[model samples]
Structure formats: C-alpha cells, structure tokens
Target: MQKLLYLLILIFFSTVAVAQDEDRELLRGTVLYLNSVVTGENVINANTRKATITNNAGQFEMLVKKGDTLVFSAVNYKFKSVVVTQDILDKRRMVVEVKEKVTELDEVVVTPESKERFLELEKEKYKKYDYERDQYTRLQNYATNSGTFYNGINFVNIFNALRGKKKKDQRNNEPLKVSQFLREMYEDEFFVVDLGIPQEDIGKFLFFCDDKIKPADIAGENREFKLLEFLVDQSIAYKKIPKE
Candidate 1:
C-alpha cells in the first residue's frame, strides 16, 4: 500500500509540471499589418495549428508559443513568415511589413516606323548600282579626261580595295552569337523575371549560374526549362541567407 501511494504521488506531480510548462510556452500577441493603405491580412500559426485574418484596421489577436511559425499571406501582398520568439511573446505584439506583389505589365513596343516601310524607304533613299550606266559613264570620263585617267592608279587595285572595305564593314556589323545573346538574357530577363529577384541582387544570384548550362549551350526549345530549373535551385540557396 505504501509503495502504491508513492507511485500515485509521483504521477500527479509529473502531470502538474507538464501542464505548467505548457502554460509557460503559450503566448498571446497581436499581429499588425504595417501597410499604410491596405489592411486585413491572413495570419497562420503552424505550431498552434490555428489561423486568423486581420480586421479592417490591419490588426488581429492570436495565441502562439515559443518556436511557433507564423505565415502572413494575402492576394495583394507578398507572402511572409515569422518564427515566434520569447522576445515577441514578451512584447505581446509584432509589426509585419509585407511588400505588394509586383504585377507585370503587358509588353508594349513603341516604334517610329514599321520594319517593312523602313526597309522600303531605305531602298528608295539609296540607289542600287547600275552596271551598264556606270560603264558608259566611265568610258565617257576616260574619253573626255584622258590625262586624268592615265594619272589614276590601276582599276583592278581600286576594285580590290573597294571589295576589302565592304568586307570589313560587314564584319564590323555581324550579328551577336547565340552564346553572347544568352548572357544578355541571363542578366536582363532570366534572373529578374523568373526568380523574382531584385535588380540589385541579380549579381549575387548570377554567381550560382553554372557555365555548363549557359543559355547558348541550351537548345532553343529547352532554354526556358533549363533556366527555370537553375533559377529554382539558386532561389533555395538565396533564401538560406538572413538578408539579401
């Protein structure tokens, strides 16, 4: 009988201690939306397994505990998460500032002239070479200005010189290679749009791009898929950082 009594006392005291610990962990606090123009956001407590939406004033009361994770989500704003801490519980309030989701605008290209019209205008502005008329003019000049013609250098040399100049001009205006184009796309479009990364932080994310999967190396059809996969992987690493 004495042994049994001792066992019951131990069990009762153990249960009370557990209850007290639970009470200490429980935290009550108000979540405040920090947006000046918008209010009423959603708050979820993962640890307590409860959810609440803010009022029109951008505030909500909720119960949480130390180590509980909370998420704030809304249609008009970016999704955010916070981990409950003893400091927050002691303060009994938290101010959450969420950025609005960036809405992409439709692509609008403004041009001074249509391509076909511009090409046609260029052709009209510059005359094409007329071989027969040029030959007649050259013969006329040769007959009328014999002294000038004799003084001129060899015609073959002049022809070769003109051809070389044309070739050099064409080379200077060559189109960019696929590899070069891909590098521009990586900086301008891929990292910014797909990853939702800020312009300033793009340089940081670019370090993660592997040279093997460079845009030029990727097939045209697989460009989007490959870039998306790479961006997703980099995003995971980027999030591990406390601050960008």
Candidate 2:
C-alpha cells in the first residue's frame, strides 16, 4: 500500500509539472539568455522566415508559440536553434550557449617536377593537333622562338629552387602545433579505428585538451613523444564523460 501511494504521488507531481508546462505555452513572449555577449546574433523563425538580431547584451525577446523553431546564427559562432516548448514559453526565458567557430585553412603543397618531364608534358599538351598541318607547325615554331618552350636552368634560379625545396621539406617534416596536431590526429583512422572516438566528438575532445597542452610545448623535436604523453594522461579522463 505504501509503495502504491508513493507511485501515485510521483505520478501526480509529474502530471502537475506537465500541466504547468502546458500553461507556459499560453504565455506571449520569451526572453533568451545569451551565455556570452555575442553581438549581432541573427534569430530567425523557421516557420515565418522572420529574423531578429540579438542586442549587444546578447539577449532577445521573441513572441513565439509552442513548437515554433528559432535559429540563432552569428559570424564567428556556430549556429544553434531551439523549438519553443510549453515549459520554455511559460518560463519566458531561455539560456543559449554558443561556441566560437574555428576555420582551418586548406594546406597547399607545391612540389617541383623534373624539368625534362615538365617540358615533355607541356609539349604533349600542344601535340593534340597534327604537327604536319601548316597551322600547327606555325604555332609550334612561334611558341619555341618566343621562349615559351624554353626550360633552361639558371644557377641562381636553381639555387633558390633548392633552398625553397629544403625549407618546404623541413616545414612538412616539422612537428605541428599541439592543437592542430591534435585536430589532425583526431581525423586519423587510428583514433576512430583503434581508440574508438566518434568523429563528432573530435572537436570537443580537442577543446578539452587546450589547458593541458600548449602549442609551444609540442613544437619541438620530441613532439610525437609529448603528444603521446598528453593523450595517455587525458584519454581516460575524456572517456569518463557521459554521452548524451
């Protein structure tokens, strides 16, 4: 009987809470809390396509009905959205957490090809037309006379090319900054295949390591060693976080 009474009481409170949430939906407007002072956050209503910008204080008031979708976007922050619920409308306030967006520039690799191979490819590109034709012969002669076909090597140019190549090779072989290195490693097959980290949590995991490892600390000859050490120390702690 006692257990039955306790169960009834629990159900009663749950029903009351749900009813209260429903009542909140009847309310007119909602006040949003911007966790950080994000200027110019665009708040858009999905249904109507209407938009509003958050004030400098990072707060916005939008009159929304239940089930209305609100999308929040900013230049440097990741976009977020919320569907208005009865409870949220009733409370007349919502707290929003926005993460700063990080953009990584694409890596460009410049490798010099052998001069002989380069010339061969260049000549072959123009060889689609029959060289026996008068027009083709004239075009080829003009190109050769104008130095367009020249691949002659100057000592100064060769020296600079070698020096540039050396620098490029050195940089390619150098240890990456800790955060970048971690980000790259996160995308590697080893992390997913071996460590079993999901792709979506890669960013979160990297952010968690910000305080633990500094960029300069990993920019040395022993970068791999330092990186391994940091990973070993933090992987356990990271795994402890409950998944949503």
User: Which clashing pairs does model 1 show?
Assistant: none
TM-scores for all candidates: the values are 0.32, 0.31
| lDDT digits (tens) for residues 1-244 of candidate 2 | 9999999999998897566445433322322333336667888878556578877677676656788898888777787888988788668777777776666554322111233333334345444645434231222222222211211212222223334545777547543334444553333443444344566766677777787866656543424344544564465577679988
Error of 2 at 106 (Å): 9.2
For candidate 2, which ten residues in a row score worst on lDDT?
146-155
Candidate 2's error at 179, in angstroms? 31
> Model 2 misses residue 212 by how many Å?
19
lDDT, candidate 1, residue 20? 48
Clashing pairs in 2: 24-90
Per TM-score, the best of the predicted structures is 1
Overall local distance difference test of candidate 2? 0.54
